[model samples]
Target chain A: MPNLYDLAYDLEKGLRESAEFQGLKQAYDAVMADEAAKQMFDNFRQTQIVLQQKQMQGEEITEEEIEQARKTVELVQQHPQISKLMEQEQHLNTVINDVSRIITKPLEELYSENS
Target chain B: MPNLYDLAYDLEKGLRESAEFQGLKQAYDAVMADEAAKQMFDNFRQTQIVLQQKQMQGEEITEEEIEQARKTVELVQQHPQISKLMEQEQHLNTVINDVSRIITKPLEELYSENS
Candidate 1:
């Protein structure tokens, strides 16, 4: 008999085995193999995260930070590998989001006070 | 220079640190500390999973299986420890569902074809 944690472990395994996850891994590896693209992606992602954190914290994002982010995005977009990785990421996000929707269904009933 | 996989790893870490996950852990620990409760929980959860899987697979569930599941649910509900664990679980689930809603926001745009 599997415990709840065991069921969670299985879900993790299922996620790893899913096509979208595997595709994301493969695309990520492709980008990593290119030193220039990897460096560019790193810079772009760092700026993105910083800006996101700022927004989340309800802090005003300075124009300089926004411009810096825009430039970084431009650089990342110019890189073919990085662009491909982003596409793969978007595809993977769709799968992940769908999975989240399904996994949280039981909670919805409770949250909605319908059960 | 964090790659996409690093971001994914960070998300996993965040989930582990979230209140919902922590609450679930505490509830699970409490249940596990009671040998009898743990054993009963294991049996009850297994039966519930079986019935759920059968329903998902669109298979015909026998009256005996339904009766068995009802009995298991009744027993689990009558157990004080199980009831407490369920309450904790519901609380944790609310947090989890909210987290899912937030995490999937970016995907929602793509899914909705609004961007």
Candidate 2:
């Protein structure tokens, strides 16, 4: 029998082979292949990271920053490749969410049984 | 500028550095270090995978199998190392859940803005 880590790696490989994941990878690659789209996505991601760090530190987000984020999001969403990437991400997230629940079912059953 | 995949890799690295993850790793190592515990855990995992596959195939599990699984979970839960591993897994899961939400916040914000 394979070890738990080995099983996890197998699961990862299975996910990579899944259509949803493949779609996501293709969409991501498309965005990266376009220099302008890549730049926009990177800027959006940097802004996202900064906001995340601030929120984690309990710092308030400013109105101006929020406006900037909104604009960046709008611009990115309007880009064909970036928009496709986000759509593919959502599709892959759905599959991942189902897999997560399925994987944890055994634990849920065990705990519920004993409790 | 770093790409989205690079940022994701950084997030993975950060998760590994977290105390919850560290605790989980130590607990996992403890269970794997004991030959008997490792054997028992592997058996439980194999049973789990079988049940998972059966369910995925739309087959109902036999009552006897359910009972067997219940007993195995109980036995493993009683094992010191296995129990510690489960406890640590819950802690790491909590951290992972939070990270999932945080990482998706950018998309969430963007969607909410347009909607």
Candidate 3:
């Protein structure tokens, strides 16, 4: 029978491989669900709607009106609520990084010992 | 000026010492706040309350009633919700343990390299 250390080593190797595959899947899902990207797309759609609404109202698109719309888009992009959410996302990323560091400690030790 | 490794080492040492102190404080607080112990004490108090309530009602306490009350106390002590909470606590402990292991990897590497 294989010793406990050998069995543990094999299990660790399998876990690392599975975790890598899972990480890739998670990254793909995150990109697909990115709130910031969705918000920006929504802002663009809203601009189109605003222009359409103005046309229906028989309002001539003036340079000043166009400039105002541009500013509104910028404001939407830089919304305080979005900024706060981004900050929270960054904080969560930090926590996840810390947790990842903790999980990888034993592997690093094993590498160092073997080397 | 200290090298990056030296600075990192000093920072790690300080963090470890602070974390150790925090862990000790948390353990002390956990012992003091033990819900199971509190529940057992409450059960004893409830028994006294029932005895008083019976005397006020002019009802004689029988051995069977006392035995039934003891079983109720046992059932309260063995509440499923408390067991579920304990399981959740154990799961959280596992996560914390995993995180701690990851965080300590670099230190273990350094130790192995120095040795």
Candidate 4:
């Protein structure tokens, strides 16, 4: 009875107001408010982005770089606020993933038998 | 008032029944019905996947490989059914991208004012 885009926006509004999103936002805000945790998270993200860029460019990433990235991840995961933020991010991702799976169903069904 | 996942399923059904998706399905089926066009399309897809895998693995793709892939693409583009399928795929992608943009709004807004 209603437009698809209208329903999409309605779903968007619902997701933004949902509990998972609220917890993610709260955790993110807490991380941002703490100077040390924020800096640690920033460094971790920088490490991740650099590695991702190398991967995207098809450049060989050395073991040393991988080790450094792992250490950076460990450091950030050790922080209470950052750890909470990461946990909350996973929760939000579950909801987002569910929506994506539903959206991609048609494409999957189309290729199911042949592909 | 309804569940977010409920609204998502509603949007999914709407998208599946939309003109863009219907057109895409029709174009795809037409390609599958023609043996010559289907074989050409399959060859093009296999070429694309091989190159994509090379890129993912950080391997050097030779210029000859690139040229071969370019020729495969040209051959597919020349086919009526495959070309129509690509055009319809683009139309469906527009609809899918719109939904994705709506769904990602919260994450965007969260990081908007910060960084």
Candidate 5:
């Protein structure tokens, strides 16, 4: 019997392929209206490609393998704007750290002198 | 001047932190009801963590860097189910290839014999 992933994979592949083929005739409409929806669909398609490639290459599939694959894909799909946000957050965090360091410098010197 | 990623990062971080803090007070409700939406949010958060960590570690940020980061995050978020689908598609493709190989074997043999 096939597992949940196998079943889900087949279903999603069929939907995507059908959508693509329909696109050739201009019969396909947007199934997902938002960026997040689009991102999720794309991510799912990519994961399918990766799995298919691995199988074609004769990579062994194990039952014990964790399905973090879904979570990983999901995480990125759910947060379409994450990368940009991350870059900004990083810059802000750096500035915050620098300011903290600067503010603490005088206190550090005063403590040392008193000691 | 800050770039797109930097601005996007700050906005997302603010939103997430506000959401989290509101969560502590039970004032936060579901901003995204679907799995895909949740996945996109998670992916964005993870990317933010990675970028923030890199910056904290003093990794250099370059202006020339392509924002495939967003695309990657978006791809995974949008297609939250892609991984499982890929696994199934891979299995199906493998079976299809094997069947094709078997079917072609007799034709190849017949051709060889005729030659």
Candidate 6:
């Protein structure tokens, strides 16, 4: 009789050990090593979060704001190291998403029944 | 600059430390301590996986199979410890889902733009 938490711990350990996550960590370290790039990324991330929060709250984002966001994304994507890190992030998130999907299947079933 | 992976690790640590997860672990341990309950839970889980897989593959589940699955759910719910564990699982998963949603906010924005 294995406790589910033991299995949960194993899953966490597996994710931490996965190559995708390791690559993400490496990219993150690279970004941290460069001050200019780090600042740029942080700024972009803050703006992104603010915009997302606005969207989530049903607040209307102006056309100017949308264009500004697009420009910030363009700038962020132009930085080689930062762009690479973003790519690695996308890859890592895909892995996490797969793991989450599998672990939450039971919850999905339960909720679907309720819905 | 704080690396994204460091933040990701923090999120994992937070989840592991959350009361919901701890409660789930406790309930899981309780179920595991009872041999008969553990066996029953395993059997139900196996059936659940098979049925889910079949549904995912677009195979029609017979009425009998549906009834069989319902019966198993009812039986599992009747077991106090197992029912409690299931409830804990639901709560823990809700916490995990919220964390995942927050972590993947940037990805959502990226994808929404592409779409």
Candidate closest to the true structure, highest lDDT = 4
Q: Which is better, 3 or 5, measured by DockQ?
A: 5
Candidate 1 Cα misplacement greater than 4 A, ranges: B1-115
What's the true lDDT of residue B49 in model 4? 93
lDDT of each: 0.67, 0.68, 0.48, 0.86, 0.41, 0.71
Report clash pairs, candidate 6. Answer: none
- Order the numbered candidates by TM-score, best leading: 4, 6, 1, 2, 3, 5
Worst 10 residues of 6 chain B by lDDT: B106-115
Model 2 C-alpha lDDT per residue in residues B61-111, reported as the tens digit of each score = 999999999999999999989999989888767755654554444446434
* iRMSD of prediction 6: 12.1
Candidate 1 residue B49 Cα shift, in angstroms, is 33
2 or 4, greater by DockQ: 4
Off by over 4 Å in 5: A1-74, A77-80, B1-115
lDDT, candidate 5, at A112: 43
Model 5 chain A: worst 10 consecutive residues (lDDT sum) = A20-29
Question: B28-99 in candidate 4: lDDT tens per residue?
Answer: 999888888888988998999999988788788999999999999898888888999999988878878988
- Across residues B15-114, which tens digit of lDDT does each residue of candidate 5 receive? 2234222232221023133456445545655676777666665576554332746675557545535433334435544543443343233324422431
Task: Output the number of the DockQ-best candidate.
Answer: 4
**Model 3 pairs in collision:** A101-B102, A101-B103, A102-B101, A102-B102, A102-B103, A103-B102, A105-B105
Q: Give the C-alpha lDDT of model 6.
A: 0.71
TM-score of chain A of 5: 0.33
TM-score of each: 0.50, 0.50, 0.22, 0.90, 0.20, 0.53
Docking class of 5: incorrect
RMSD of each candidate? 16.9, 15.6, 21.6, 2.0, 26.0, 12.3
Candidates 2 and 5 compared: the better one by lDDT is: 2
In lDDT terms, how accurate is model 3? 0.48
Pairs of colliding residues, candidate 2: none
Q: fnat, candidate 6?
A: 0.00
Task: List, residue by residue over B7-65, the lDDT tens digit for candidate 6.
Answer: 34444555555577667777877887788988888778878999988876557899999
